[model samples]
Target: MNYFIFGGSGFIGTHLINYLKENKAGSKIYNLDIIENTHNGKSIFINCDVKSEINLNIPVSENDIIFNFAAIHVTPGHPDYDYFETNIKGAENITAFAEKFNVKKILFTSSIAPYGASEEMKMETTTPMPNTPYGISKLVAEKTHMIWQAKKNQQRQLTILRPGVVFGKGENGNFTRLYWSIKRHRFFYPGRKDTIKASIYVKELVRFMVFRIENKNIDIEIFNCTYEPAFTIEEISNSMMEITGMQRKIYKIPAGILKIAAGIIGAFGGKSIGIHPDRVKKLMISTNVSGKKMKTSGYNFHYTFDQALDDWFKDNNKEYLS
Candidate 1:
């Protein structure tokens, strides 16, 4: 079987490619991305962007699988139109290409942003109430994939994963920022410490993706990829300290003051400082998602939050602590 991964040069895609190479060896793998494939040339790279039509001259079979991870996901980083232009258009193009090739299985990596910034636990059954352009576009993209599956109900299979804050090697996201803040003794709670930040390890996410597609009995399944009883900001911070043996006094600042400060800093060309108003707002909100579905499906999570952090540190050659 052949694996076609769009956006395969990205953080999650890179990890997925590595996982497939180690586990599903001998399978033909093709990485279709606009960026260069730098994962030691494990998969065939195609210089293709998903925002436009996907044209592949290589041979493909109906039994082949397609993984779509293409999206402009960073909030406050891009203009509103950019998110829709890329994410929605990318989904449309990807599904169209799949239909053209008669590819029956598609696995999409969506985000928990569709649930909005809520402290309430979100499950697959929760109604999507997206608040941002990125969230709305992802929700629409999910529908695009669903529409494709519905056209060939019996023959097509679609698995949509809504993961929150996925962190691991090469992820220069929230976890990385937190690590740096604590290591530099500059970590602090923004507004409050009880805000839930549902997260998952990239390795576990890829494993679950494979497990769901291989063992699914339904035509389309939507699963929330996060730890059940999601960790609070304080809990996560404390865990990081314990795991890394790094201790620092964390102070809680009022959300309003931080927002004003971030605005002033951003207005005066403090972008490189990595303190934006939007990011500050994000810290104050909660993304309390649930992963009970994956657990009840008999899939075992190989890494706890702490273990995942430890593994990520090792993967980075322990440079995070250094």
Candidate 2:
């Protein structure tokens, strides 16, 4: 079977492609993305933007699957309209392409951001109350894919995965920044240590996605992709310290003060200092999400939080020491 992956050059996409190459040896994988495929050269790379017409001459079969990982996902990074333009339009175009090719299955990577910041543990059945542009766009995108599935209810399969702060090798986002901060001895708890941050390793995420697709008995499945009983700030920091042997006396800084400092720095081009008002505000919020649906589905996780960190350290050539 062929695999058409949108945004396959990204961190998650690169890992997914590698996994498919290793597991599904004979399958032809086509990566369609605006960015160049710098990680996997063996996969067929086609320069295409999801927001525009996805015109490809490659052969596709009814059994082939489409994976949509394309989106402008970084928070506090892009204009509000950029999120809707890429995420919403990208979903429309991808489903259109799937319909055109008579593809039976599609796996879309949505975000837990659609659930918004809340101390309450968000479940798949919970009503989404997205506040940010990125969150709103992701929620809308989910509906767009659902609309496609509803049209061909019996014949088509759609799996929408709403993952939390995914981290692993090639993830230079939240976890990486935290690693660097702790390594440099500049890290400090912002106000409280109990702020919950729902996270999943990228490898585990792709593994679960594949598992759901291969073992699926239903036409549509929407699962929240996150580790159960999510980690708190203190627990995460302690784990990093133990795994890397980078023990340092953790400190607490007032969230109010940090917010003020971040605001001043942002106003005076302080992004180089690695603190922004939005980022500071994020520290105070909890993304408490529940992964009960995935767990109850009987898919055992391949890695625990600590194990994932160890593997990531190995993949990065043990850069945790540097």
lDDT of 2 by residue, 1-322 (tens): 8888999999899999999988998998888998887654558889999999788887888899899999999888899999999999999999999999888899999999889887898999999999999999999999999999989898889999999889987777888888888888877788999999989999999999888887645488999988888899899889988888786988999988878888998899977656778988898899899988887888999999999888888887876722
Encode model 1's per-residue lDDT on 1-322: one tens digit a residue.
Answer: 8899999999999999999999997898899998986878689999998999988899999988899999898777999999999999999999999999899899999999888877777989999999999999999999999999999999899999999889888888888888887777666687899999989999999999889888646499999998887899899889888877776888998778878988998899866656777888888888889988877978988998889989887887766732
Supply the global lDDT for candidate 1.
0.88
Q: Which run of 10 residues does model 1 get worst, by summed lDDT?
A: 313-322
Give the clashing pairs for model 1: none
TM-score of 2: 0.97
